[model samples]
Target: MKSIDTEKINVGVVGLGLMGTSLIVSLLIAGHKVKAIAPIPEDMEDAPQRIREHLMICEDAGTLDRPVDCYLSQLVISEDYLLLAPCDLVLECVIEIPEIKRSVYKKVEAIISTDAILASNTSAIPISELQKGLFAPQRFLGIHWAEPSYFTRFMEITCGAQTDAVLAEWVYELAHQWGKEPTLLRKDIRGFVTNRLMYAVYREGLSIVAKGDATFEDVDKAFRYDVGSWITLMGIFRRLDYLGLKDAFETYNRLAPHFCNDEQIPPLMQNMVEKNAKGTRNCLGLYSYTPDEAKRWDEAFAAFNVDIYRLAAMYPSQREKKKTRV
Candidate 1:
């Protein structure tokens, strides 16, 4: 296999929405040339400014080593798919509808080289399902990322039924260049690793609230104060080991029967959706927020991300520590 030169990589991002624009900054910070294609007119108009603002925040947080312009100069934001002809990798971050995503894939495949890898930023869709009808299905995979992509280290690289394993491993190496702790899933599954674990927690949390065992605020505090405290330093498996797994093993056996096994969506979430509550975007979430309060919360979350990024950096992964020793 040919080695990828990280410095010279030209990445194209389709769909210049929130995650798409944020992802460009990440690629730019890692010293890659980026071509951003906004499929919609609104995204084309808003993406540049949003990207600039995100970079400024990164600069303020000392994450961006050079001036924002230095990074901005590496970016080319447009509505033209032809501009993606030179991109070594292209990420599709459009809406989650299968039809919409497949349409974007058709246009992208027409432009990029056969060797160029095509990936999706899908959080819920199965990678194999999306790989269907693609001209080069072997080169297609899922490259899921968390929000505020530049600040977060989480990335999931998943392989579909037809995805080439060697190519998937290449993306694993590439993700490391982007400063991500990427997990490569050899087999495709809905929600992959992170979402599967998170959704389980959500199901249990919602079940408790619906059963009147605890209020949503109560559940939030437990998660924020308990799980939030040590999760950054150690994931769940490590936490179990740290606490002595014997007790955990016993507790799990005892509580297994009581766990929520509901297959249906929780009523709490259904009701919220019915009411058109879009959280901070509309200031109508589980907890009441005035317009001012909602804006403040949004600002606070962004600032908190920066702080958490710095904090997480202080504790490098075991893999990094092993490298340091070597």
Candidate 2:
């Protein structure tokens, strides 16, 4: 009913992990008042410090002119759901478990206003399935964000079958105000857009290494040097268009059946998990890393996100041309 453009509506975030905290910082930077719920004593204890670190990152990037405390003043980390009754939008960012997310939605729906739009930052779950057993399914949609939400300009607003189209548009415009390159998906689908494409790459890359066709570094080297050079500017289809080559079509015909399309989890990844090789968080994953190197990679990626976000802003992705009938 009201204009979302240039509006500073109250927003509520249900989780306080890295993604949730990063999202809260992004909202604060976009001039919205936010109520964030960490839901656990440990998370609540760390939320303030985590947010302060991000605020300082923004300060150094020259995006936020005010001191960290100035933005901190706008955020409320609360344990109560009643505090969220006034929000215009509420996003659930719980872990990727269905039961945990369903319980959160039920609790959040009970206290919020009927008109408040409910959204999920779910990367893999289907919004249509998540809307089951909700009183007002029309208000629920998926608002998937790329990690380090404060830095990444990408946002996906996906609408389930029951979602209200008008509410989805309001959120779409709001994402633009927050400095995001937002997309609206009219239909709900698993993994939405980005995750689906990215996971395909993951599956193929892992298969290559597991089959001993290449080492982890070799795969990374090829991707970084080849795909990396133009991915930030244009996607694969556009690159193919510019090159006047359809080499991939013939290559795919030869390789389609050979590609890994197994329904079961790869033994490679399962063994890694069984061994507790959990990547930088645990200092080992697909590739081995010393503790110090792991820490450096983590910090370096965070730093790179800030600058890469700026560069992405400078050259945002373009929408594809719609094919017209002859």
Candidate 1 displacement at residue 272 in angstroms: 1.2
Candidate 1 local lDDT, residue 51: 95
- Please list the C-alpha lDDT of all candidates, in the order they appear: 0.91, 0.86
lDDT of 1 by residue, 206-276 (tens): 99888899998999898899999999999899999899999999999999999999999999999999999
lDDT of 2 by residue, 1-326 (tens): 66774336999999999888989888998888898887777888998899899888888888886778887898888899888988989999989999999999988999999999999999878999999899899999999988787888889999998999999988987887787878899999778888788888788888888889999899899988998889888877888777776787788799988888876777888899899888998887877889999999998998889888888777634432221321
lDDT of 1 at 28: 92
lDDT of 1 at 78: 85
List TM-score per model, in order.
Answer: 0.95, 0.91
Residue 268 in model 2: lDDT: 86
Taking all chains together, the TM-score of candidate 2 against the true structure is 0.91
